[model samples]
Target: MFNDISGKYDFLNHLLSFGIDKIWRNKLLGSITFASDSKVLDMATGTADVALQIAKEKGVEVTGADISDGMLDVGRVKVKTKKLEDLVQLVNGDAENIPYEKETFDIATVAFGVRNFQDLPQGLIELHRVLKADGQLRVLEFSKPKSSFVFWFFGLYFNRILPFVGKLVSKNNTAYRYLPVSVNAFPEGQDFCDYLRNAGFTEISFKPLTFGISTLYICKK
Candidate 1:
């Protein structure tokens, strides 16, 4: 599904969010606290945007793993263009079974990717397994709005206008439509925090971003 619209993913992300997507991502980055030598893992790293940002911080080693080759190809080009070959590496891997040794990474992140996991809890477990003791994990994902007015307006945009524009721009019929469906069906807030706890994380918490249009979850091993 993602492979089909890989080329237009980034553009549509920025366009659909009216460039707020970057601001959201930057917010996620700002909340991360790690040492320069910490190794970071970015799961479901479609297009490697999160990995690229981590590399820019300097000294940290970043590995971006994703199942979609098409998205990874574009990400690789961007990495090369940024001359971050030494700091960042892209790999073919899955969320349920990441291709890294247990306790390897000090920090792990997934941006708008957890909902796409076939087994959400298992994917969280995999993320936990790959992180060192006390390692931090963060997830950024779409969420339903809380306020009445925000919910009403955002729903119209998300369920109607956004998908239409996405389809028009990406020319992929099912991908955009599937996005809202998946998000709506997926668990959020406390439900998601439970999954993290079941996956062996501690100190779990989340904060809504942009009027609850999205959420940022933070936890530790």
Candidate 2:
């Protein structure tokens, strides 16, 4: 599904979010802390936007893993174009069954990808396993708006306009349609925090962004 729309994914993301996604990612970046030699794993990295952003750190190493080769191909091009090939590497992998050994990364991140996990708990556990003892995890994902007025307007835009625009741009009928369905079904807010706690994370918390249209989850192990 992702591979089918990989070419148009980045374009549609910026268009649909009105470029607010970058701000959201920056917010996640603010909460993450690591050493000069720290290694970061970006799970379900899609086109590696998060990986690319983290690679800006002077000596940070980023590994971007995703299930779709097409997305990785586009991400690799971006990395090469940015001359960040030495700091960032893209790999093909699954979220539920990551190939890395335990305690490999000082930080782990998932941007707008946790909702797509086939097994949410298993995926979270895998992320936990790959993190060092004091590793931090940050996840950025779509969430339902809290205010009634915002919820009504956002719902109209999401359920009506967003999917229409997505289909028009990507030419993939089912992919965009599945987006809202998945977000609605996903456990957001504290319900989601429970999953993080169950996955062996401590000091877990989340902050809503853009009037709750999205959320950034922070946790430590």
lDDT of 1 by residue, 1-221 (tens): 88999999999988889998888888888888979799999998899999998898646899999999999999999999999999999999999988888999999999999999999988999999999999999999999999999999988998999889999999999898998899899899999999999999999999999999999999999
Candidate 1 lDDT: 0.93
For model 2, name the residue pairs that clash: none
Error of 1 at 120 (Å): 0.6
Total clashes for model 2:
0
Which runs in model 2 stand beyond 4 Å of their true positions? Answer: none
Q: What tens digits encode model 2's per-residue C-alpha lDDT throughout 1-221?
A: 99999999999999999999999988988888878888999999999999999998546999999999999999999999999999999999999999999999999999999999999999999999999998999999999999999999999999889999999999999888899999999999999999999999999999999999999999999
Error of 1 at 83 (Å): 0.5
What's model 2's overall lDDT?
0.94
